[model samples]
Target: MTTHHPTQTTTVQTIFRFLLGGALILAGTSHLTWARTEFLAQVPQWVPLNGDLVVVLSGIVEILLGLSLIFLARQRVLVGWVVATFFVLVFPGNIAQYLNHTDAFGLNSDLARGIRLLFQPVLVAWALWSTGAWAAWRRNK
Candidate 1:
């Protein structure tokens, strides 16, 4: 009887995942502390919660997701899906920042903010690709 071992993630994918995780951790830390006020620019005014509370909560969630990305290789597919969903869920904030002309993170002009909005999908793709979620999903289908 043969016991099958899951294939290891490639070196490039591992490195990219780590980089993404590190970026998430740093950004999450900024959300809770130094960049709290700056993050407010992304919060839609229509949101019922206090902006600070939203930032803090999201920061905690980011830290958890980032850590999972770094440490949970066996569960990478699920993590990838969750991370992609997270990117989707938070996209409105990016749109709000662009529409409201809020200056944060040095994204002062509408062009800059609009450009920033374009990167969210890239992040979603990164999460899915780096973790092999897209490939796994395709293989299963």
Candidate 2:
């Protein structure tokens, strides 16, 4: 007989999850406050909605997602999926920033922007790992 236990989260994973949640909250606050103008640079030109509106809305979303990550441990797997999806959804903005050479968040150089673009997938992976979402999905397969 084979016994398979679900993947359990480690202390490191919990810490990272909290850290990521805090980061998202801080970033979202910035989007609505001191860094609002800088965030504008990330809004792709093709997005028909007003850049200000988009930034504001995304800020709100980030805050809500952050809260979920921090407080929704019971639903962490779902929250992880949502957070990872959010990372994927925002990738185009990162790409647009890099391609358009729009400076924001001190990523003034193309290299810097390019590097930031590379981190999106890391964020997605982080969300999945920290919340055990990847483990859960894999276990079900």
Q: Candidate 2 local accuracy as lDDT?
A: 0.93
Question: What are the root-mean-square deviations of the candidates from the true structure over C-alphas?
Answer: 2.8, 1.9
Q: Compose the digit string of candidate 2's lDDT tens values, residues 97-140.
A: 99999988999999999989889999999999999999999889
> Alpha-carbon error at 113 in model 2, in Å?
0.8
Whole-model alpha-carbon lDDT for candidate 1:
0.89
The ten-residue window of minimal lDDT in model 2 covers: 2-11
Give me the displacement of residue 90 in model 2, in angstroms.
0.5
Candidate 2 lDDT score at position 71? 97
lDDT of 1 by residue, 1-141 (tens): 953233256789889988888888998999999999999888899999999899999998899889999999889888989999999998999999999999999999999999999999999999988887887787678
Error of 1 at 39 (Å): 0.6
Looking at model 1, which ten-residue stretch has the lowest summed lDDT? 2-11
- Which regions in candidate 1 have their CA more than 4 angstroms from the true location? 1-8
Clashing pairs in 2: none
Tell me the deviation in Å of residue 7 in model 1.
6.4
| Cα RMSD, model 2 | 1.9
